[model samples]
Target: MGDTFSSLLELGGPVVLILLVISIAALAVILAKVFQFASARVGRHGLVRQAVTQWRTGERNTAAQNLIKDRSLSAALVRNAMDAIQMLDQQPLSSQERDIREERLREEISARAADRLFALASWLKALDLVTQIAPLLGLFGTVLGMIDTFQTLQESGAAANPATLAGGIWVALLTTACGLAVAIPVSVAVTWFETRLEKERAALEVLLTGVFTAGSSSTVAST
Candidate 1:
């Protein structure tokens, strides 16, 4: 292990360090996501269950308080829904006004969902940047090795055999291989993380949809 790392350091220290940093960042992201989405604990916890409970009972304030108590990515969406429902329930309204209120609530819900999406996009962009640059840096190492090999050839004249210059070419080959290895996995990880996020978002949507429809149906039946 030590010898391999030493070879990498000597051949392309900057590229190796950059890839190391990216790998750390990617690892952190994956761990965070695993914790956040695995058991529905991080984002769901007490608030989401309470939101569903409140919807069943038509108690918007209970849902709002539950939402306000927590600050996960899902909280904003629940809070938006609670506030919109409360606003519509309290307002002096003709039927036209009620329709307007419902439309406004839909818009607010979508707006809240939009808020945390930028963070996801930023994470994906960082991974993509690393994926793009790793191969190029590896290619740079290969080019530098070729330059060193040619320089040695000039100094040694016809005396140097191809076997003598193999070390430099080997470094070039290894760097390119390492770069590709780093890039391919990082790109795949980015895709996998995005898929995880998509599933979580879908869950959130389903939770909200069921609660909203149940709440509205119960309200109408009571009226």
Candidate 2:
């Protein structure tokens, strides 16, 4: 293991070292996000639908209690909407005013959902930066190696060793290889993460919209 790293260091120099550190950091973020998503139980389904059914049955507080005790994102959003319903139910507002309150409540619920999504996606930009710059850094290393090779040839004049020139060229190319190595996997990871986040967002939107529609139906039935 040590020999392998040492060979990389010699071939790629400082740029390789920097790229390796960035690779490690990116991996950490990826793993941490995976764990976070797992812990969040984002995959849990049906909480919102069940809560909506209960809400429509005039068990509003009970529905809210059940959802509030859950940890999933869908549950959290439904719970917020339920809380708004409970508070609004206590007031003496007219029908038009009540409609306005529900509209605002819908916006508030969506905003909270977006905030949670943003938190999940926060460190992703750093991964994107690493993905973009890794190749450029590698190219920079290539340039540095070529410069050293030419400098050696210039100093040696006509007697420049062919083997020495070849070695310099090889080392110079190593940087580009290392850079691509660092970049490709990180880029793939970033894409996968974004895909998963989008799926979650889409699911949340469907669930929240369903809850809102259910609440509206309940209000219509009561009058």
For lDDT, the strongest prediction is: 2
lDDT (Cα) of model 1: 0.69
Candidate 1 C-alpha lDDT tens digits along 1-223? 9998876777765666676676677667667656545433333545676676766666655667777767766666667776676666677777687767777777667666655654454467777787898888778877877888879978999798888688768866766777787789888877876776676577677766755565453374495
What's each prediction's clash count? 0, 0
Look at candidate 1 and tell me the lDDT of residue 110. 64
TM-score of each: 0.72, 0.86
Of candidate 2, the 10-residue stretch with the lowest lDDT total is: 214-223
- Angstrom error of the Cα, residue 38, model 1: value is 7.5
lDDT of 1 at 200: 56
List the pairs of residues colliding in candidate 2: none
